[model samples]
Target: MRSDYFKNTAYVRKTAVSSSIQKLDKKDDELAFAKFFIERLNQFRKLNYRVVSSDEESSGADIYATAENLETLNLQLKTGEPGLERFWGRRRKLGSGMGIIDVNIEDLLAQIIRDSEKHYANKENLTLLITERYQPVFDKNYALRISTMFGNSSFKGIYIVKLPSFRASFPYEGQIVAIKDIFGNHGEVF
Candidate 1:
């Protein structure tokens, strides 16, 4: 329910972060998603941000963008069950660049939050979560609570973009981008 402080959390609270979901096994999805995100950011047509691949032990931020020598971090990726049908009742809250939020999103959200906490603690330079397309497990519960807490900014906190499911195995195809549609329009956030 805390908006302004969602990104600002006490150090004690940050040390206690954990998750149980398996590491994302699909690199194709990772690259595809990262590619799209990078392209989109680059398309902004301003100063360009640099994208860096994972290296040994450095633990550098994922995608770092810069303007006028000012660098920013972007942690864009997927979360929880690939099949979005699992989203039933959940809520998402957004805050400014430096804030603290007490809500949990998905498995990926947990990891991102945890990692960001670590990075910030180490005095690294990183900003912006850009966690759009977050699909909550429930609607009314989190929605009502988030609405009550955030009011007008509630919508800005989350962008419920429609995501099609990804198929693990496709025997009859060379390559395909699998997507599951709720109304067959490929599930755009309504």
Candidate 2:
């Protein structure tokens, strides 16, 4: 009985450690993405900005950025292609050899709008930053479509940061598109 108790305690300890490690890994990923996002935005817009401490992240914003001559902005960062899990599930059921998986941009936009409405309602100075790691294309059509979805969103801006796969040669830092501009107009790429 004592041996079983010891084993259970050990298992609990291992599980706790594993959970802590996972949390740390997630935090690390968020910090790395925030740094990359800020650097790219600064380069493109010629603005100086710094990410606020992680402790401030509990306010429903993944990141908080501060810049001179600008209001402190609350950034909700989402990574990964929206609806990617469903795509993978479909591919698996079809037996794997499916050539060229295409992500549905409309579905992605709809998901973002839903997330914005759910999480950021009545929040001022909030921006939705989606880091699409698998989107193959970020073009004018995508910008316009994304912008159209946010006609009544509470978010001040919606930006998609397209980080290409390891195969792309140009735009090593990836691309940024303003789906909805803070100034209340259709967005443009930086």
* Candidate with best TM-score: 2
Residues 1-190 of candidate 1: C-alpha lDDT, one tens digit per residue: 5854664575435644422122233434444445444444455334465555553256534433344564444333333434222232222223232223234433343444455455454322332232333222233344345334323221112222223334564122111111111112221212
Q: What local lDDT score does residue 180 receive in model 2, on the 0 to 100 scale?
A: 75
Report the C-alpha lDDT of model 2 over 113-144, residue by residue, as the tens digit: 68667766555567777766543455666567
TM-score per prediction, in order, is 0.35, 0.76
Which segments of model 1 are wrong by more than 4 Å?
1-28, 63-85, 88-124, 127-190
Which residues of candidate 2, in runs, are more than 4 Å off? 56-58, 85-103, 164-172
Clashing pairs in 2: none
Worst 10 residues of 2 by lDDT: 97-106
Judged by whole-model lDDT over C-alpha atoms, candidate 2 comes out at 0.69
